[model samples]
Target: MKIHKEGFGTIITSTIIAAAIIVPTVLLVMPLYPVLGWITVIAILGLLVFILSFFRIPGRQHADGEDLIVSPCDGTVVVMEEVEADEYFKDRRLQLSIFMSPLNVHVNRNPVSGEVTYSQYHKGKYLVAWHPKSSTENERHSVVYKSGDKEVLVKQIAGALAKRIVNYLKPGDKVKQSEEMGFIKFGSRVDLLLPIGTKIEVQMNQKVKGGVTVLAKW
Candidate 1:
């Protein structure tokens, strides 16, 4: 597994702290409290492993096609229904939401090849990933891509545990299907609002991988 570049600073800082503080603290306690020292060592190691795993970017083969809509993030499909979109579309749209836990990869990807037509970031409250109102109330970066005659909107939402929303694209920028779009630090959710007539390809509670699983075909 490859470590994502986003975690480089975190991993380096953690290593330095372990060497400067944790290791020496363990050594000093080993003689008087061997068991406590060993436990501390294990906890520290576990934390490092968890942090490393959180940002691991596994190799992926992006599903490429002009009409294919790939999963934008790894998680279980939570919302798949028609809803009134008040932001960009301001009309009824097919909404597909992916609920990403801290354990899953936090990277976001483009679902289709298109030119970004709308991009905006909103500062809001941090709610749980699975909360029904999280998609609308949480801090999010909204992006819309226009492919020929079709347009799709994707939103990166910040969850209770997620503190940062990193988006790499802007309006007028062209993006390829399944290419990296951004990364949501820690846990969060991704929402895709498709045209009403688009075919649905996935079901609720089904696990999907970013840039791989097909969510629908436009």
Candidate 2:
């Protein structure tokens, strides 16, 4: 369990903030108001831990098979159904949506190994991750991967609490399955559009781990 590269700045900032409060509470406030200062210390510690955990990158072995689709991020499956894709596909596709809470790992992994064919970032609103409109209306980045004759799309969406999104892949780049694609700071959502007729391996509301969970097989 290592601190994810994406959280270096965040962890440092969080540490400074936590220490500012914790040090003062321990050295001065605690001497005067023991109960109140101790509570403040504990609260600061909890917040620091949460921030560290959010950026943690746990080791994981990606799902096997080039045809298997792995989860892009750790979160709960919020939407799974056939939907009309208004983006690249412009046709009906099976969509799987994952909602990432602050408690979940924020690293977005590649669902499949392929050459990136389409990559775009959109400026938009910051609604809650589960909001239906957030998938399209929220600040997001979309990347499509192609392997052989199959192509899949993944979108990283910003939620009400998430304001920053980091995507490293661009068109023409070849990415490996389960490799880092992006990181969404704080809470967010990820949408995966699979080819029609693909088998859905997970159900709605199911919790999934990034890189480790098999979403479906192409």
Candidate 3:
């Protein structure tokens, strides 16, 4: 319901655009150059793009169950593969990968309520979100929450354009479903590896709201 301050990068971009236009108008208007006026228009357009990227849409759903499964990130479902998870799960799982573009909201949330059982940061390569090798190659933060008799592992992977990944939770930190856990810079992807036989309520290509839509149910 509230639009928080945008990331520092986004704020800097907006500031550059605003100053490029308004500052010149106040200091260089004496010359009355027509070229500068046109430039001002372009700069203002850039500011709008920065605003859109920082805007946050209100969530439309809430959690009401002991094991509710909220969407881990705001993005379109691009992949649902049967792959063996790297850690924690170790077994084959239904890996639901959501590709978050630079335009998508980068805030990630807890999908279920539980204790933080495992958390690890892997410094690796920055690959494309959809790249099959990205799951192993990308710089990723892996966090596992043991909730309702199941262990849910959420991996925040930084893509080629993303340079920073922020995870706010730590060991023993009790996270609630839909609570803000971290934010990914620019663009990246979040992969949720669910246990086999878990009921998935989302379709492949469906747009999901982080902390809102239930991707699955135990």
Candidate 4:
């Protein structure tokens, strides 16, 4: 396992805060209110652990195939349906949405190996990740990947608790399947717009791991 690069600043800040609280509690509070001080210490440590866990990247063999599209993030599949893509394609597409909870890993990966053709950031409302309208209404960074003749759009959307979305790929950049494409701070959602008539491999409400779960096939 490895800590994500994105968590360094957060982890450092949390450590400082934890130390500030723990040192004072141990020296001042523990001398007077031992139980309360101990409780405070445990609570602060637990929160710090959770913060570290959020950025942990566990080692695993990622799924890969020439025609397969892997999941781009860890979460539960909240939406799987056909919809008219209004932003980029402006055509019919099969949409798959994954809702990332605060407890899940928030790193986003590339679903396929291809050249990035479109990358754009949209400023919008911060709706809850699982909300039906959040896919289009929430602030998001969208990227389109082209492999051979097939193209797919992936959107990193900000949820109520997620205030920042970090995307690394831009137009013309070559990305590999299951590689890091971005990271969403805190909880968020990811949307994939696949070509119509593509075979859907996962079902709604199914849990998926980024770079590990097979999402579809071309």
Best-fitting candidate, measured by TM-score? 4
Per-candidate RMSD vs. true structure? 1.1, 1.0, 2.5, 0.7
Measured on C-alpha atoms, candidate 1 has an lDDT of 0.92
lDDT of each: 0.92, 0.92, 0.82, 0.94
| lDDT (10s digit) by residue, model 1, range 3-117 | 8788899899988877776777676988889988888888888988999999999997778888799999999999998999979898999999999998999889999998999
RMSD of 1: 1.1
Superpose all Cα atoms of candidate 4 onto the true structure and report the RMSD in Å to 1 decimal.
0.7
Worst 10 residues of 1 by lDDT: 18-27
Error of 2 at 11 (Å): 1.2
Identify the runs in model 4 with alpha carbons over 4 angstroms from their true place. none
Please give the lDDT score for candidate 3: 0.82
Shift in Å, residue 160, candidate 1: 0.4
The better-scoring model by TM-score among 2 and 3 is 2
Candidate 1: regions farther than 4 A off: none
Once fitted onto the true fold, the runs of candidate 2 whose alpha carbons sit more than 4 angstroms away are: none
Query: What TM-score would every model get versus the actual structure?
Result: 0.96, 0.97, 0.87, 0.98
lDDT tens digits, residue span 79-173, model 3: 88788777877689888989998788778889999899888999999888879888888899999998967988999999998888889888888
Best-to-worst ranking by TM-score? 4, 2, 1, 3
Please count the clashing residue pairs in each candidate, in the order shown.
0, 0, 0, 0
* Candidate achieving the largest lDDT: 4
Give the range of the ten consecutive residues with the poorest summed lDDT in model 4.
127-136
